[model samples]
Structure formats: C-alpha cells, structure tokens
Target: MTTDASSSFPFCPERWLSKGIWKEREIPAATTATATKKKKKTETKKTTTTTMTTGRALEAFDEGVAAAAAGDERARRRARRALVRACEEEERRIGREEERIERRRDREEAEEEAAAAAADVAVVRAREIAVANREAAVERRKEVVTEREDAVAVEMAALHQEQMAAGGEEQSRGEEE
Candidate 1:
C-alpha cells in the first residue's frame, strides 16, 4: 500500500505522513496536490485541475494528525483509523520479517547438521576401509608363511631320504669288500 506524501486540499496543511515501514525520514515543509478549479466563461463551465502546495507534511504523527486541519468529529475518526491502520501495518511487517529470519536460521541449522552427519559417515567409512585393508594384508602374510613352512619341510624330508640311501649302499659295499 502507498500513500501520497501530501494530503488533498483542506487537509493538506496538517502535514501528517502515513507510512508503513519504520525508518527515519525528513518531513518536507510543504506537499502539493492537484485540485479541480472551476471557471465560468460566458455560460460555459470551464473546469481545470491545477497542482498547488497545501501544507507541510510532518514526518511524525502522520497517522493521527493527518486530519488535524479539520477540527471536526469525522476528521478525528479518520485520523484515529489512519493511526490504527498504520500500527497494524507496521506490526504485520515486523511479523513477516521475524518469520523470514526464523526460516533462514532454521535452514542454516539444518544444513550444518546435515554436513556434520555427512562428515561423520565419511570418517566411519574411512576407518572401515582401513581395517579391511589391514585384515587383507594379514591374510596374505599368513598364506606366505604357510607356503614357506611347507616348502622347508619338503626339502628336509628329501635330504633325509638321500642320506639313508647313501648309508645303506656304503654298508653293502663294505660287507662285500
């Protein structure tokens, strides 16, 4: 919603500025509005609208004092309603801003939590992978050790068999001699 910087004639000089957003503003000395001006020219009704400066629109009490120029009951009611509307509008705006901030905060918090969870999962996976690699290395070492022991046992057995055959042949030859 928007409002004119200056009120129309008869209410203009009151200089009440009604705005919704809260902020610092500079009230100008006077505000202008276009009003209908009539001129009778030889039985012809000539009408023209001209812009004129009426009153200084004050930055403060814009809603309550807008109708200040009229010291009447209707003007007072209008002013009251204007002030109330302004207040309600401001409240709505503040509420919307707060909701927006809350949503942003919630989104950020969720994202941070998700990131932390992902990091934790990654760390767990890395550890599991490391453990798996270590286990695999251990199995390879066991296989290598078992193969070496088997090979050594076979070599010793063959050497013992050779010695027995040589001893038996020597005894026979000696007996023959």
Candidate 2:
C-alpha cells in the first residue's frame, strides 16, 4: 500500500485530522490561537521565524510512526513525548508574557490615577492661596480707610479750636462797643 504525499500532506491545520501530531483530537477553530513549533538546527538557513511548516511536522510524525512499525517503539514514544513537552513549554512562556502585559496595564492605570490626584491637590491649593490673597487685600483696604478717617478727625478738632478763639474775641469787642 502506497501513500500519496499530496493526500496526506499537512498543508493546513484542517488537513491534519488524520495523520498529524495531534492524533484523535478535534481540530480547533480558526479563532483559537494554536500553533506548533519545531526546533531549528540552522538559524542562518531560514528567512522566516517559523523554521518548520505543517508539512515538515507531518513528515516527522510519519517517520516516527514508520520507525515504530519497524519495531522501534522507543523512537516513536520519544518523538511524541518531545513534541508534547515542547508544546507545554511554549504554553508556559506565553502565559508568563500575558501576565507581564496585564501587570503593565495595571501599573499604567495606577500611575494615571496618582497623577490625577496630584493635579486635584494642586488645584485646591491654588484656590486656597487665591482666597488668602483676596482676604489680605481686603484687610489692607480697611486699614487705609481707617487711617484716612483718623486724619480727618484730627483736622476737624484743630478748626474747632480756631473758631472758638475767634468767637470769644468778637464777643468781647462787641461788649466794649
């Protein structure tokens, strides 16, 4: 029995239902973030970050199966085990990165809140200072008015004494006439 490469090729995730790394499991929908990673020995050989395609992954899985069918069960189990371990590690790393992102967002919100509170405090302090300045100005105006009234009262007292003296002299002069 010969297997056609095109028929069993893992071109996309949907076609990996029968013979891909994920055996007997339902394929996740397109919205789910699911991807498989393969270890690359040569970094300079590839232009893209993804060194292996689905086709190459499927080929590795098939080779493992063939080795097992040829009486090498250890090789097949090790291959599957390594794949599963790699997937788990990738999941852990992704989780840590997501947690870091969430913490950063929370920190940014806290900083914004602190800045707003500081601004509010500054506004209140400015209003208090303005009110104090206005009260001081009013006190200064009252002092000026009180000083002017005292000066006017002194001038009136001096004019009254002059009038009294003049009136006495005129009365004496009229009695003599």
Candidate 3:
C-alpha cells in the first residue's frame, strides 16, 4: 500500500497542491478572522492605558502651570509649593508601596524562620521527654532489683536460724543420753 506524501506530511508545502486537500479548506479565512480579533483587542487595551497615563500627566502639568500664573508673588509661591508638595506626595506614595513590599517580604521570612525554630524546639522537647522516660524506666528497674535482693537476704537469714536451733536440740539430746 502506498501513502500520499501530502496525506502523511500535513505541514509540507507539497500538500497545498495535492488532490482533495484544498477543495474544502477554510484555514486562511479562519486565521485572518482570529488575527483581526486579537489585533482589535490588543489595540483597544493599549489605547485605554495610554489615555489614562496621558490624562494623569496632563493634570499634573496643568496644576503646575496654574500655580506659576498666579498674580500675587505669595500666591504664586504657594502654588509652586503646592506643585512641589504634589510631586513629593507622589514620590512618597511610591516609596511607601516599595517599603510595604519589602516589609511583607521581611515578615514572610521572619515567619518562616519562626516556624523552623519552633520545629527545632519541638524536636528538642521530644528528645528531652524521651530521655526522661528512659531515666525513669532505669530507676524503676533498679528499685525492683534492690527489692528482690533484700527479700533473698531475709529468707537466707531465716533458714540459718532454723538450722542452728535444730543443731542445739540434737546436742542437748546426746548429752542427756
């Protein structure tokens, strides 16, 4: 059985001219539609972002120009001060955001360290408890051994006394005879 090269290799250029391949194909139309949709969405998003940024910059510049155009020197100075204050406020806001991020990172690291330290402490405590339990077991065993030794010694002493009594009785009987 022979397989057509176009049927076997779908992406090969030779497949485009192959029989029965281009008859029902809508790939070009579909690709164009998809490309147009993607381009439209991206352009819209870009335009919106640009407009917002430009609006903010224009507002800042207008405030600065209005302050510089004040009739009285003191009023102009106040406007200039206000513009400076606005710029400083923006800088401070940016700095605060950066500091907040840094603080969050530091806090996360500290919490992780604390958790590790807590785990270490738990391990140490468990080891200490195990040691304590072992020591108690050893002490109990020693007590049991000492009690057994004392009982044995008492029984031996009693046996020796009984033997001595019997010997004395025998001696007395012989003397009498």
Candidate 4:
C-alpha cells in the first residue's frame, strides 16, 4: 500500500505539497527511491554542455590516444604534435599581428609628418613668390616715371631751338629795312 504524503497533511495537502511542505507518510520502497534519485541525477547531468575551447587541447590528446589504440602510430604522433604546434602557432600569430599593427601605426605617423613638412615648405615658397612679384611691380612703376620725364625734357629742348631760329629771321629783316 502506497501512502501519499499529500493525504497525510492536515492542511489543504495539495496546496501545501505544491508549495514543498514536508509531511509524514509511509516510506517508499528502496528500489523506487533509488530509481527516482538516479533519474534525477541523469537529468541534471544531461543539461550540462562544455562551452570552452581550452578543452580542445585535451580533446586532441584524447584523439591521439584513440588513434594509437586503433594501431595508427603515425596518426597518433601527428595529432599530438599538431596540438602542441597549434598552441605555439597561436602565440606567434598574436605577436606578429601586434607587430604588424605597430609598424602600420609608425608608417602612418611618418607619412603625416612628411605631409606637414611639405605643406610648410609650400607656404614659404608662396610667400617668397609674392614678395618677388611685388618688388618687380615697384621697379616697373619707377621705369615708367623715368620714361615720362625724359619725353618732357625732349619737348622743351625742341621749343627753345624753334624760338632761336625765329629770332635770327627777325634780325635779318630789321637789317634789310
């Protein structure tokens, strides 16, 4: 005869039992209790799964052992060596990646510095060109002023020569009268 704990409780047993209230009842058969415990254990175990890749090394070692058991000595050695080599290679790859990144950063900085220097040189050259152009313009203006003064002097000299010729003609007429 099975005695239900739910029936033994004085309070509303169904409600209290659902709430995990303990009550006294006849003990279950040893076989049934053991079976229930085993089932619960199995269920809990089934829920767990390994998620870390660090276990891969152990897995590779286990594979190597299995390969040796299968009478493949070369396969076993290869797998074991591969596991070790993979770890070493991963470390080296990380180092090389870091070095490459550093080199790229250095190169970019150098290029930027060169560009800034070139821009500075360009600005200096532009200023020099502007100064030279201004000086040449001033010199051309001076030359123009000199040429205008020379032309005016030549016109005054010509007028003085014409007046002297007219005075000589007037002196000849007075002598004839």
Query: Which of candidates 1 and 4 is the stronger one according to TM-score?
Result: 1
Give the TM-scores of the predictions, in the order they appear: 0.61, 0.57, 0.47, 0.43
Q: Is candidate 2 or candidate 4 better by lDDT?
A: 2
Candidate 3 off by > 4 Å = 1-55, 58-93, 169-177
Model 2 segments more than 4 A misplaced: 1-73
Q: Rate the local accuracy (lDDT) of all candidates.
A: 0.58, 0.61, 0.56, 0.59
Instruction: Residues 1-177, candidate 3: write the lDDT tens digits.
Output: 014322332322343233322222121121222234654563322111222222333343344445444444555454445444544554565588799999999999999999999999999999999999999999999999999999999988888888888888999998999
- TM-score-wise, the better of 2 and 3 is 2
1-177: candidate 1 lDDT, tens digit per residue: 133323332333232333323444333434455344556333433344321111111222354344444455576566555544554554565688799999999999999999999999999999999999999999999999999999999998988888888999999999999
By descending TM-score, how would the candidates be arranged? 1, 2, 3, 4
Q: Which ranges in model 4 have alpha carbons more than 4 Å from their true place?
A: 1-88, 159-177
lDDT of 4 at 57: 39
Name the top TM-score candidate.
1
Model 4: per-residue Cα lDDT over 23-107, one tens digit each: 2223222232222455456332223333222244335445666775686778766766755654455446558879999999999
Candidate 2 structure quality by residue, lDDT tens digits, 2-98? 2442233223233334444443323233343333454734232322333233334445557655665676778766655544454454446558879
